[model samples]
Target: MGRPPGAGAEGTWESALAAHLAFRGAVLDVAGSTRRLSGELSRLGESHWGIAGKAAGLFVPHVEYGQSQLRWIDDELAAATRLAHAAAEVEDPDMQLALLRLAGPRLEAAMMGSMLLAVWFDFLNLTDATLSRHLYSVETLYVKMERWQKMLEPSMSALASLEPEQVESAAEDMPALVGHLTREFASLLDTIHKGAKVLETALVLKESMEALTMLSALRFSLPAMRPALPATLGVGLMVGPNGVMMGTRIVVSAEWVEMMRQLVRAGVLSLPAVSAAVRIQAGHVMMAQGHGDLPRGVRDALGDAPEVRAMRVTGKSGAGMAEPPRHHVMPNEFREWFEKRGFTGKMRIDWFCVTLQQPHHQAIHGGGNWKLGRKWRGEWNQMIMKALRDAEVGAGRMLTQNEILKIVAGYMKLYDIPMNFVRCRGK
Candidate 1:
């Protein structure tokens, strides 16, 4: 939160896909430049540069989140484009123009409110990345510091041997060289103390964010955000992997990503956004974004948890509609994968379940056309398979259910899938 919003170039979200990419490039450039500055620091050759650089790397998660949102939003932009083109056939020129703008404007509106999160997620280690969260932790700071000190040990020892054994060089009387070294050491300690304070304050803020998250986007930071559960699951970064993590500077929140999807789909495929756009009076400039004072229910309702999503789909419960199909939270296709893990004995895969509607199941799997389906469904499956396979192979053993779930939570966020499910955990 200490990092302010990014001062990106003057542009619109209409080019959201491109904007997202450009945002990533710009961040990477700055981060690269930041890392390169360590070269100047490296002249000292004591690895202090590494210690300070770790503090600067805290934004890695920000980059990851931004990139995660970018993948999902690419789909959004495609949907928006489809809608913009569709509007030309169904509506007048004025209406079409308004509809076209929705490609960027609707997403802009949805992503707008989430720009400033009321709650801060401190559960993560100095970064926003949920998966592969390998940043320089304070615990590791001390370890690196030792190496840094060792690098200078030989030189310092040499200096110590000549520390005026009795001030025989009194004629020169230039003050002991060790005194300057002591001052330098004090400076280093002060810097470390300040760094520790920053990390400590971050922890306190995490608690504060949790307590006040009543109005936050999704409760996933507290637990996880899931579509079918009483709660939700964590979504991945707005951008990531080789970029400066300017949190909320790029895509805002995953909550915004979902809403943006809904708004875009509504505008392109149907009437929700189209009708709303038509109603805007002439000489108007998207007055409804209302970011300055985002109403209470907006952020609170952004999550797509089972209850929240159900409530949004219909004003009330589905009294007569067919119940959603029940599916194992862990895919059935990967049963062998689970059995090899600790899923045997008390931990049965069937114990964890959720109701995934037929349409959604299809959407996630790219169940439709064979060719285009190859794009999303295949990649999604490959990612899940690769994660599990790689983790086990790397560790050279089966993974626990919780460990497996950690992997699941991350992929779900990247794909923007909800993590609602009923589960029974066991030893």
Candidate 2:
């Protein structure tokens, strides 16, 4: 593909530059919201007692995680801004291509980080809802018992922070994070249930109808919050509003894609190869989050058709079994296909194939099952994916599958298998 006319035109480049800035602003917005939510949680902890007190403790770690992630996003955005500015100033096509190469991944990372922050925001909202209901019940019943409603005022202030925007901001974060928060909050809900029951039982000691009535209302109100909790904490973030897409597929912005295409056309990037490398990285991200199948749009963008399956070779005993199989077997056709497509030593494929083989002769004879070996391979694959993404940007092109293998093998010595044992047999 050749560079289109006016690819370096000021208007064309400025529009692309503007998109990066817009993405940065979105990320900053999410970061600001996170900071506010965390502050509110800390204030709530200071004022509340009983169920709210317990919840405040559970929320502490999550808030810290959100803040840390926000800092990382800020760093990425700053780097992207600098690169885009440099790219915009350069007249030389090669220099511009080089700048775009550096900027593309950073922008993509910022967008992804923003989406993650959005998910965390959702979790904070769910926490807020539970706190709100508890505070409301306390305020209502305290007045009936002749205790001043002003005594419950601190909790009311905490509830005020659960604005619609703050709650709605969490709609786009990662499903894995949402799923994790859901489980954590579900556990917290169980604690709340038990605490409420214990409080109800103790109220019987007073033997006053007023005390019992307060207890009844408290019990009823707390459980009412339970139904709302699941929608917000459990299922809401998972399926989202549409209840269809399992994970957020926030595609790389088109401006970034166009920039990459210009770089490729200018001989700064290897066509098809860089695209394959990027799609592979994206696939790994999805798979790590437990979505093994790529969305159709993503597949189309990568020029990967539905019929091309990434081969998965499992041992007959178990996929991650302790013992190595008597013989390691791979489909001959799969091997040929991989070689033909120049995917021979791609880190992901390499790790999969290498780990599937029986352990090194020393390990096998030394009574070591390939269990730990397999685990090591999995960890190394993840590291390699990160390395590959870095290499793609740094080199201004995709690393060949063999090149990726060498890089990963240097870091982790897990690929030290003899060639004879790797058998490619026909079905």
Residue-level lDDT of model 2, residues 1-427, one tens digit each, is 1233556466545544543344345435434644554564454345344224543354444445555655655665565565455445444333344344434434444444444454344434334444444522443322222222222222222212221121212222233333443344345545444555344432432222122111001111121235322222111112222211221232244433444434333322223322332332232223224333445453343334332222111224366656353332122334553355354431113222323334453253233654554255343334455566687789897665444434533443344442212112221
lDDT of 1: 0.35
TM-score of each: 0.25, 0.35
Which portions of model 1 show Cα errors greater than 4 Å?
A: 1-317, 367-380, 423-427
Q: How many residue pairs clash in model 2?
A: 2
**TM value for model 1:** 0.25
Clashing pairs in 2: 119-173, 122-170
Please name the candidate that would achieve the greatest lDDT relative to the true structure. Answer: 2
With candidate 2 superimposed using the best TM-score fit, by how many Å does residue 285's alpha carbon deviate from the native? 16
User: Once superposed on the true structure, which residue ranges of model 2 sit more than 4 Å away at CA?
Assistant: 1-65, 115-178, 190-195, 198-292, 301-427
